[model samples]
Target: MAEGDPSYIDYEAFLDPDFSPSSFANTLVTSTNNATDTPLDLSTPLSRVLFDLQEIDTHIHALTTKSALPLLSHTQNQTAAADHILKESGTQVAAVTQGYERLQKEVVQKWEAADEARVAAENSLATVRLARAVSRCLTLGKQLESQVAEITGRSATGAATSVGVDGASPSAGRDGFRALERAAYTILSLREMFSAAAEDEEGYGLDRVKVIRTLRGEFVIPTENMIKSRAQQTINRFSLSSNSANSSNGQSSTSSGYKQARDARARLATAATTLYLLSPEPKSSTTAVDYKPELLLSTLQGYMHTAIMTSVNSLARALSQLPSMDRTLADISTRCQDIVALEASLKTLRPPPHPLLASTPTAETQAAASTNSNLLQPLLHALDTSSLPSYYWRSLASSLTSRVQEIVNRGGVSARTLRSNRDRLRIEIKECVLRASRVSATSLLAEKGRSGTDTVIVGNWEREAAVMVSSVVGPLGR
Candidate 1:
């Protein structure tokens, strides 16, 4: 047989030589291992073997069917489909990862923005609180004014009952001084705080003008009025001294009117200086009159002028009844001391010039004329020279000088727009003083020194009055 032939291994004898014939006798089988063997009848031992062999064949056939050719052919296609799906899932996972990252960044930014907004809210709230505090200060200032009024009244009335009451119980006066000082200090602190807030032009919440007006109405005006009243009362007390005293000099030995007048003058100076400092500086031409400080200053100046005039008029009236000029001169000389004190008060009233008012070329000429207008000219011209004696002009000059000095001293520092107005006032008062002095001197010489002469005796009185006026004017321009 050829080696490659299907029947390469011929049927061979495989029956066991020792096998009993009976063992195979019952089996209906053919033993291919033994070519000489014949078909046999079925038996118990052979049947058992046949059954075990059949079970094994059945398992092999089942396994072969599961791994059939058709099923094997679809394996590649399944594997390819799985690969495509896995690739698609990978891409989706990457996209999801990127989206998650973006969301995380957005969340972080939102949190940061929220934090910033919270901080801004807090800053705004702080500013509002400061503004409220400033407003409350103004309210308290009003209350303080009322309390001061009551205190002043009580002090005035109490003064009559106790001669050395204030001296004995200095605590009351010291307490009053401390209270006034405390209130003033509080007002200044508030003003400084508000001014700092206003410096931040972008974030400033409070109205500048409103703050100024509040200070003026609640603080400055009340203080001015109180001082004015005190001065008047002091003068009134001095007037009573002459009636009560039995001194040979016809003046009170207990309290001289001259000394009292000096005291009153000092009080007025203190009031004027305080109010002037309390006033706000003007930034521009429009704000010059609009600013509370400016308005308050103007009001104070007018008040001081009126107050001084009242005192002067009162003194003049008191002395008018006297027969001798010597007694009147002595009294007038004492009042003149206030004029010297006026110089110090005037220095405090002046402010730095505003740049805006300096640059307005269009109104320059008109402004100059308006500013230069003399306030005293009309007052002097309108006076009834026929009714008033020549010596009356001397008293008038002395009073006018006090008013003029105040304006002149403040001229350099006041706003340009306001300066002209003050100058006008100063000029008027100064001119009026000059005119009155001239008239008084001419009248005195014509009536007294030149009585026998045909030509009017051009006496030394004109030179003396001129020298006095020149002395006051010298300090004014400087």
Candidate 2:
């Protein structure tokens, strides 16, 4: 609006500071600048207060009384914005209060309903248990009465009653279950109680229901005595087998022959298990669970012999094209199987001589001994002769053949005899190894001698030749 408008005042001349037309503006200027020496404009704080008071007093006089400004609905945006903020804040508070009330009421109601259901379920479980208990009591009474009648009905003079439930003889059959009538009854009662305790009022209306419907799914809680009895019976059977093995054969080196070998092994394993159980303390050995030394020895010897006998024949049959060397490799080659199989089957911590091997010696072994004597005769002549170097092969072959002949001709001997025969060959091989230009061939001869006519010899010869081939080629650069 222009300064000349009705609301605009002529205050530009007052800014000249030459004259004051208004008393309020004059008093305000004087009080404000007295000590400060600064300009006190009409708009100063003291002047503003005075002007407002003058305006108020003048209005009061003009209208007799001034009424407060009516609280108007805001036509201006600032007033409307403030009203909008207050209204939104109140609505938010109401929403929050309503949410809190709803959640609290839901939680309290849910807890009460859960408690009621729990109480009902627990009450039903208790009722079921009580009914079962009563049924159990009645069942027990009935069982006792039956037992009493059975006892009373027995004739004291001649008729004899069997133990409790079944007439199974304590002698013919084991388990002595007939004597455990009372305990059996108690078990039945407890089984019933457990069955009832597992159910709720819905399925079992006062009558005890079978909680375990499937017989296959039923629980089996064996008593300590029952477990002990079963274990003892098993143990006794094991002990019998173990004892029998000791007395059977083993008198002859081949006493536990190949025919009865399987039964022997089974009995041996069983006996070992029994002994382990009977032992006051158990060891950590894998076989300690069932290691019977005697049985183990018997089975081991039998298997060893079989292996030696079988391997020799197997190797001979397999390498049919090599028949020229068959007679040489087969005899002892196969028997080496005995030695090897004997060793393989042994699970002991030591490399002891197989008991059977020690006791029983084959015919081949006896021949080896006789051949050794003949071997000494040839060595004397061969060593002294000037043609020894060239004739070494011939001499070695002849000596080996003589040994083989002895082994074939002489029947079986003792274990000591067999070892003695091996010792002779070992010494001859060691001695001839130095004198004989063809040591590899010489060693082969020695093996053949010991192996004799047996297929085992041929097999051993083939293996030894393989090793000899390796040794010879190593130095010759072949």
Candidate 3:
């Protein structure tokens, strides 16, 4: 078995690169970096991780076969006894004892079957994590590479410095370093799987526990950022599409005005598909959840910080061109802005410092400071009650609030696409978000940050962080 080789295993069999975890990394960083405009090194690490996972998955499958043996043997013993009893003249027997024995045997086989599976699933999750890690790494890697390439392209001679985004300097970008940290976390998650599997109970039917839950534990789902990023990629592709269209066919309508709604819809569809294909596969998520809506909400929140702000900014630039959808879109944009503002307000809103100053900041004081950092929950609740309808509601909601809304609902185009993806990414997104929400942010962030693949990228943070901070500080310096 060669390392990074796809020969023994099927990469496409487990996940589609077009829409799978593979898709996010394989396409994202490569495209972001490609001087050639195609996928390159992204697959190398993905293949390595996938290969690692395939090896582990095979082992887990073998363990499942092993765990079933005791149950099978017990069943056979009972069958034999029952047959003997039926042939000989019926006698009462210990079916309860036999069943208990079977259960005990299985439990004895794997002490924490569910827990072990949870661990393995967490480990297996690294498959996607690795992909995301590499994707971000590649993107940031390219960011550095572009610097080198730019320096050398014109100079065309002297050697450039060995330092890069991969370098461990705080100055390049406190933000850039943060991006590197995220990428590292994801890769580490992949690496951590190897050790996590080793840590499981001996001879335990952990595979049996997989049936109980889908790798139950905290996992981050990057739903919001993913969608926003995808939209960003999509928008870029469409800008090209329009250019190509104009070049080949000539502009059918002026770049300005509302009369071009028909052309606009066509453009949007083209952009959506282009975005779907070119869109980077999202990072693996660790958020846990029991159901769907909570997951979706969490995802939207995540994206609120990343591409949403950029997309809305693009949309604003595009209004003259999107005049047909202007009024409805403006309303939606305003609502989204409000959501962003509220989120900002929450981040800033904190209790005043107590009048009693201490020699050292107490544990209680630290806890209180930490509490100031997370106002997302209560603020979200307030918005849910007081706000205009969510965009998700446009399709999932029961009623339409306005006639102009007919543009979105007219043919159910967006709804159909959204529905098709219902089972694919969003569910996974939801699960991931829920799992993340369960964990302590400090621990979660720290854990992911340790991995070169799992650190945060500041350009992608929700825009309202500063706003939230400002609001929390208020008029007086408390």
Candidate 4:
């Protein structure tokens, strides 16, 4: 059969060299034409079926040719356009794939670099913070050491420390104490620095020993030295006043002596508080067990003892010669003079070290206060007689009593209140003397002859007494 035509082939005739395909095709056409002319016989079923199939096949082939004609023309027209699109698409895909690969490699590298940079920056910050903490702590420690050395040198040489522009030491007087107070306050603030610096070490490793030891060596030890130096100076001043009083003629240094003594006592209190904080437990985690700085507490007690004794001794000697009622009154009047001096000294008293720098008191501190209180008993007993209500007129005594009462009423003493007290004392003394004169005159009159001419005698006696009193009161002119 031919490829384009599904017609029966005569292979035997084809094999014969005499039979050509064109001659055979003409014979087939002649037969079809002859059959068309004589085909009135549709009587047999098989012949009828074959003839219908032949007609159906011819109709189908014609319909297929008609439908495929337009499709062929359209394909011929679009062939060049389709080939161009395919070729361009393949090139574009190759280029896009290469570009995507490059982009992926670059993105991966950049992401890795950014991550590394972030880690490095974080590490640098941590290192900087650690270095800062170390530097700050060490620097503060060095300053503390310098202060300790300054204090020790001054104490050893008996030279006053140069504080700021004042050219004075805290040991000099009230102003010196003020400087010491400021120094102590600054030292106490170091703990806060430690806390703030410690917070940065979240995952970072830090040496706990270095931190605690630095605080101990730099801050705590030097503070202890300051306390001891202050206490020693207090004792020395008390000794100087005592010696001066002993060598002077009858006059007393009780006022200045007591003032210095009281100041020393206050300083000791601050020292005790500081010591307690520095050495809280027997084995402190923040400090060394063997280096608690409690050794000087005994020295502090000695200073306090000497100071109180010096004041008491000076007062006792001054009062020993209270020969008359007036002298006793005068001594009593002057008793609060020392107290007034003490109040003035207290006005300029330095505030205690801040609690952050202060620690719990040790057994030695408690003992110091206790032993001092015990030793003060004799001084208290000696002054008991002076405080009692006496039959003799307390002209100066009343004034001094009122001065003490005013101080007590005001809760604490100040410069202003002390001045007011001095003023009131002067006024009260005058009033007391006037009242005493009246009492004396009335007694004289009662003792004399009251029946006849007693008024005249009493008047004459009072006139003479007033003259003598005026002469005695002359030296104390307003």
Top candidate on TM-score is 1
TM-score of each: 0.34, 0.24, 0.17, 0.32
Candidate 1 lDDT tens digits, 90-183: 9999999999889878986788889899999988876776566556656655655544543353343344222245543343332232343234
Q: CA lDDT of 255 in candidate 3?
A: 26
Per-residue accuracy of model 3 over 178-207 as CA lDDT, tens digit each = 222233233233223322333342212332
Better of 1 and 2 by TM-score: 1
lDDT of 4: 0.43
Which structure is stronger by TM-score: 1 or 4? 1
Q: How well is each residue in 1-478 modelled by candidate 2, as lDDT tens digits?
A: 2223443234455467777557745665677666566654545756566775676566556544333233233345668898999999999999999998898789877888999999999998777666655565445544533432332333324243444355533321332222233333443444434343344422233233343222212322333234224323332232122222332344341232332333322333333232223222223322221223342233333433343344334433322323333343433332332232222122222212211112224566555434433212222232353222222223333334333334334535432243344433343333322222222111121222223221111111332333332322222221
Model 4, residue pairs in steric clash = 170-176, 276-359, 276-360, 277-359, 277-360
Clashes of 3: 39
The per-residue C-alpha lDDT of model 4 at residue 461 equals 27
Instruction: Go through the candidates in order and give each one's C-alpha lDDT.
Output: 0.42, 0.36, 0.36, 0.43
Error of 3 at 108 (Å): 31
The RMSD of every model to the true structure, in order and in angstroms, is: 26.0, 23.3, 44.3, 24.1
Ranking the candidates on lDDT from highest down gives 4, 1, 2, 3
What does candidate 4 score on TM? 0.32
Which scores better on lDDT, 2 or 3? Answer: 2
Off by over 4 Å in 2: 1-48, 56-122, 133-222, 236-478
The better candidate by TM-score, 1 or 3, is 1
Segments of candidate 4 deviating more than 4 angstroms: 1-104, 154-179, 182-186, 197-339, 348-478
Clashes of each: 16, 29, 39, 5
